[model samples]
Target chain A: MSVLLSATRISKRFGGVQALSDVEFSIRRGEIYGLIGPNGAGKTTLFNVLTSVYAADDGRFEFDGAPLSGLKPHQVAARGIARTFQNIRLFANLTAIENVMIGRHVRTRAGVFGAMLRTRATRAEEAAIEARAAALLDYVGLAARADDLARQLPYGEQRRLEIARALATEPLLLALDEPAAGMNATETSDLRRLIERIRGDGITVLLIEHDMKLVMGLSDRVLVLDYGRRIAEGPPAQVRTDPKVIEAYLGTGATSATRAHAEPAPAGARPGAVPGAAN
Target chain B: MNRAARPRSPLAALGVILVAAALLVLPFALAQAGTAWVRITNLAILFALLALGLNIVVGFAGLLDLGYIAFYGVGAYVWAMLASPHFNLHLPFWAILPIGALAACVFGVLLGAPTLKLRGDYLAIVTLGFGEIVRIFLNNLSRPVNITNGPQGIARIDPVRIGEFDFSTTSKIAGLTFSGPIKYYYLLLVFLVVVIVLNMRLQDSRIGRAWEAIREDEIAARAMGIDTTSVKLLAFAMGASFGGIAGGMFASMQSFISPESFVLVESVMVLAMVVLGGMGNIWGVVLGAVLLTFVPEILRYTVEPLQKAAFGRTIVEPEVIRMLLFGLALVLMMLFRPSGILPSSARRREREGRQP
Candidate 1:
């Protein structure tokens, strides 16, 4: 499989502390790749770097065979990569449907005069766009709340709406930063299915998730991180049994002490035995 | 999409239409009141345009502009220099209007470019300084054998003429009839209509949505690939162009141009029109402008005459009482309807749905 996005030795530093250091990662076309790590493990920083919200200090990235260094966040988005923020950053005053419609702004060609006159072409395009927005909302179970302001939605619905908005951009690669965070069991399960459906559509997904269950269950390949470095990478079965992965999560001493307790649970065997199973 | 489809509520449409129709006939209905009433009507229409122009900046773009009248001052001074007798210049009104508008747009961009990076209240202060600087420049630049003619102001401003038709109230067209305050009033009404339509179109356009997005969330707007700097400049230029147009009409109507007319208070009055009517709403701001301009004149006549009739002398000076009442009305409106009279439905609903 061709690499859809490739990052070589990416590193980011803020003041004195390093957020991400020497991180080499690649995402292939049509796979749900998961980034799993503990809190402050630099998953979001990596996403930020990939999306060009923050420039990596020591490395570079390429998307779809084009260099992405020194690009603005919007430029990255324009180049067919879309992302959802870990904390839902939405145009809160805008309607739920309007939020999705904005995602289609890159595709809308109507100028100021055309929009003002509501020209035949503008109207046709707008109708088509609205219909697409409506369909996306339905896909995310927000059809009834299309006209409601985004901030009015329940917490879980807001997350889904963000995903819907990102999808409206018609992205080739969707980077979801902790989409299943703060969701209950039912919501997490629903998100896992949604992630699968997204990947099944032949779009590549780079997900940053704390929910080990969802990550281990849904990802085609999982990359583990410890202190801004990739500690392990493999299919869930090999990853779950990797001693480094255990050390990254449970501490070095705990890994050795719990090696007998941790090794038998094959990564692909599902997250039922793990205490902290992710979505 | 159906042009023939009647509005949803006949009674509501009838009420609105009836009021508009009555207002259309107001000049003739108040014809007996002579030129004073006509002047008041003219002033009201100009203010309405001015307010609508400012609305495009502060209301739609969420950029608090305190120097909006600087554009008006620029327009007036530009037109004065081009068409006034002081320079022995005779640019046709049509040509002068565009020049004036262009000058203001250039100045608007010059101001907007550097300050567009500033956020919120700081932008307002910078704009306020810009307005004052323009005013002081006009006041001081008259000395060395007169370029601006200084505090003397500009006189003999040639009236607006269309083709061979002179539109001056004193000059007859084709020896048949002379234009009057009513003619100027109608001309301004046409300008107001054009402005309202343009504003409505702008508000619904993609650029308009980008502005609204910036107003709501700047970071998100930028993330969506909207160029914030270019968009802000467009808002400033578009808003200033209306100020230029209104300045042209004012000069034609008064047949004179002066910097005093574009004072800071005038800027405040235009802004008051937007806030009092509802910012970001076209019709509401127009109504607010008309009310603010005309109500004071009406009160001046009624309050003094009524007091004199009852007390054999004026009980309260009309000027002071009018200001007091106007101030109180603004205060009450701000307290009661901060969103203005015809708040956008989206905004009203948002306010209503906010958590306590």
Candidate 2:
């Protein structure tokens, strides 16, 4: 019921391009927050700022009631925020389970000496790590391929493996960037179930997805960005009816025509079925 | 779990015994060359340790460290300064070895801190400079301080001695004569075993997993909550410590310390060993080290003699020809097997995907 994370006036610029400007939103705890926009909506830039992958040019973030500004990516993760890359940047040379084990690194206590000597405590911790990593693989439906190299896995499975790896971090906020980007229909459904299952476990999720169907289906609340700014934010039904979101997705010409037939729009029974909501 | 049980299997146990027997007879079998063969074997083991250490950084962590030999030099010089008569200090080997390793670890962290932001070729160039910096300091520190003895090098450094037994001297035990080089062979063998086991243990551990993760994708590793800088620094320090231990052993075994021994070429040789065998594979590194050590010697022995017998004169300098052949072999290997002769299983999988 409380806010898990919030950004205030977050802005970032890359040389000539203002990647994100005055973007702001709050994600409630135990909710799937969807971020959608046309191409280059600065959604990923916002994620980068939230995770401290990039220092925001303006503004700050608060996570779990503490300021989350200027922390390194690893430090942000250690504070219970973990993320997956949009393109599925799994540790390609590592085994499926090892990728997940790396996610548990911040939570583990073994050091170089402990690992080298394999002391009683270190051994026990390592065994626990392996057991948890295997469980995460099973959670993501890749238990049978635990020993397979990550790069060797098929594309859809690699995306799932990335999720499994992120889950291993014991994150309070799991930020997935384009998790369903390359999933087939079945995989997308599975991913939707997995995201719901994650929320069922009481963790907040920030999802950046182009698969409109999956986003509308899973997200409790939705935020729409256009060119670098937040254009709309609300429950999906309300957001889908926002003319600003419509103009951003379908451009100026379509907006005027669609606005004339506003009552005829049906508020888009399936948001994915709305012509202007393809993004 | 099965890894713990592997060495105890009957077949593996037999393989272990046969290897032990072969190693025991190795020095004597090659003793016909009047200790030169045994000396070569000792050097090979030392390089194996060096290669294994480099593997920690360049292989597992995917950080190229060309200055790795600097730590080896640090270890050797620390041992020389503490145990040799030049300093009028005679610390026991047990006391000096840890000091050597710790000193090298500190140096590794020092180098790693500044260079942590750099990756791939930039890291390589900086590390190369670091290696040269250490070597030049060793070369010039004789002035104003008279330390390192400059280019003349330090001589008569103490050999590894345990209690009443002096490893520097030849001893006859159970009718088998154990010369200095022969004793050194066993000592180096033990150290090499320790290093190899240490590497193998590290390669499968949590830190090792973090390292491989960083090597594969630094950004993703960070996103997963890995402190990339510290993990990278650990890799540098771990690699340096191994080099330090080997350096101390080298100084003690040879009873001398010299700057010429830790040049960029030596660093390149160790790096080559890691790549030649299999970057992340322990046995592959040892195999590469051994082959590189002996291959030159094999060429030295056979190439010139055959050249003279066939042509009644040498067509090219044997040294140049030796290097030319070595370079050619490496190039061919890269073309055919970019990963190395004995790649880690993960790397083997990657290679299949890459070529396919």
Candidate 3:
């Protein structure tokens, strides 16, 4: 597969605290690359840097072999990288379809005068955008609720709707903050299949997920971070057995804080422990 | 099926027909009542047009523009300077109106370009400052002497003419002489209709959505690849252009121009109209403007006579009571319906959905 995106030794700092330091990441075209880390491990900070929400203090990112530097978030999006926020950030007043249609702004060329006059070209382009938005909504299983106000949707549907909106941009590289977050087993499995199908369409998927099953099962390769620094990187099997990965997950400040405050699961208990997992 | 899938109401069609009927017959009805009343109706409609224009900026785009009246002032001054005996350069009114609109649009961009990045309250203060500066400049331009007539103002502004068909008393058209309030009333009505229709079309366009997106969530709007600054400037300029057209019409109708006419109070009145009716909703602003403009005149007739008859001394002057009531009404409405009487559908839905 071709390299869709590459971030080389990216470092970012907010005031005196280092957010990301010497982190190298890349996603091949048509591959699902998972970024896993404990909370405050700079996963989101890296996403922000790549999307140009926060400019990196050092290092550079290139998309499709074109260097990305000093571009705004909108400009980055226009360059075909689209992302969904970890916390849903939709225009709540707009309808579900309209939310997706807004993503098509870069693609639509109708100006003020053409819209005012309802020129033939503008009407045709508007129709085309509507169709494409509808198709994206369908791809995310939201075609039935296209006209509903986005805020009115149930939580899981709202998450899917956000993905649909991002997809409406027709991005080659899709960055999902957490696609299986807050979902039951059935929903997560369905999301897994859907994400695979998205990859089948030749779009590179860069995802930040806490679901270890999803991270290990679906990702072709996984990159692990501890305290804003790269700790391990490999395929699921190799990374799973890596001592650094276990120490980072089980010994880090995040896991220790939770363990110190909350009731501990028994030793040898795995994170996504289902009913008969010990067998 | 989605609840939002419900078809758009035919209320728009009903509204159009009703408005057309009213515009066609209201002048004739008022002419029968009295010439002064007919003239008042014309003035109210002119103000309504101005209010609608301001609404596009303040209401729809969520930009609080306090200097909106400056565009109208500029338009009136442009007409006065181009077509009045004060300048002795009598251009046709039709010619001056377009020029006035273009000039205001140019000024609108000039003001908007530098300030589009300023958000919320800062924008309001900047615009307010700009309005004061314009008024002061116009008031003190007597050094040029031949241009603006300074504090004395300009008078004897010529009526609009269209191809040997002057709207003046001496001019005749199609074997019938055009004169008095009725002619001007019909003319203003036509302009109001055109503006209202254009507003309706604009509110549905991609540009309108871009404005709303900016209003709703600027970061999200910008992330969607919209150039927020350009979208904002377009809204301000288009809104200002409408004010300019109405301003030109006001100059020709009154045959007078003054810096005092475009004061801070005038801007507030236009804003009050938008609030009383509904922001982002064109017809609501129109309704607000008409009601607010005429209610004072109606009160003048009733309050003065009632006070004179009852107390053997004037209880309160009509104008004072009218102003007091108007202020009280606005305060009460703001307290009761902060979103205005006819909130935009998108806005209404959002508010309703926010309820626990």
Best by TM-score: 2
Q: List DockQ, one per candidate, in order.
A: 0.40, 0.59, 0.37
Q: Candidate 1 lDDT, tens digit per residue, A1-279?
A: 999988899999999878898888888999889888777778888988887778889898889999899887777888888888888888887788878877777667777667657788877877777789889999888988887888888888899988888888788899898898899989988888887888888789998887777788888898887678888888887888787777666654555566656532222222233433421
Cα distance off (Å), candidate 2, residue A6: 1.6
Residue A116, candidate 3: how far off, in angstroms?
1.7
- For candidate 2, write residues B161-202 as lDDT tens digits: 999888989999999999999998988998888887778778
Candidate 3, B1-356: lDDT as tens digits:
11122354599669878977987777668767887898889888999999988988887678889998999989999999999777688997768989999998887888899898898889989999988888888888978554677777899998877776566554455775445677888788889988877776566556777777788777777667667888899988998999999999999988888899989889888888888998887878888899888998899888887887888777787779999998898999899988778777654454345432
Task: Determine which window of 10 residues in candidate 3 chain A has minimal summed lDDT.
Answer: A260-269
RMSD of each: 4.7, 3.7, 5.1
How well does candidate 3 reproduce the true complex, by DockQ?
Answer: 0.37
User: What order do you get sorting by DockQ, best first?
Assistant: 2, 1, 3
Per-model TM against the reference:
0.88, 0.95, 0.88
List of chain A TM-scores, every candidate = 0.91, 0.92, 0.90
Looking at the true structure's interface, with contacts defined as alpha carbon pairs within 8 Å between chains A and B, what fraction does model 3 recover? 0.47
- Evaluated at residue A53, the lDDT of candidate 2 is 85
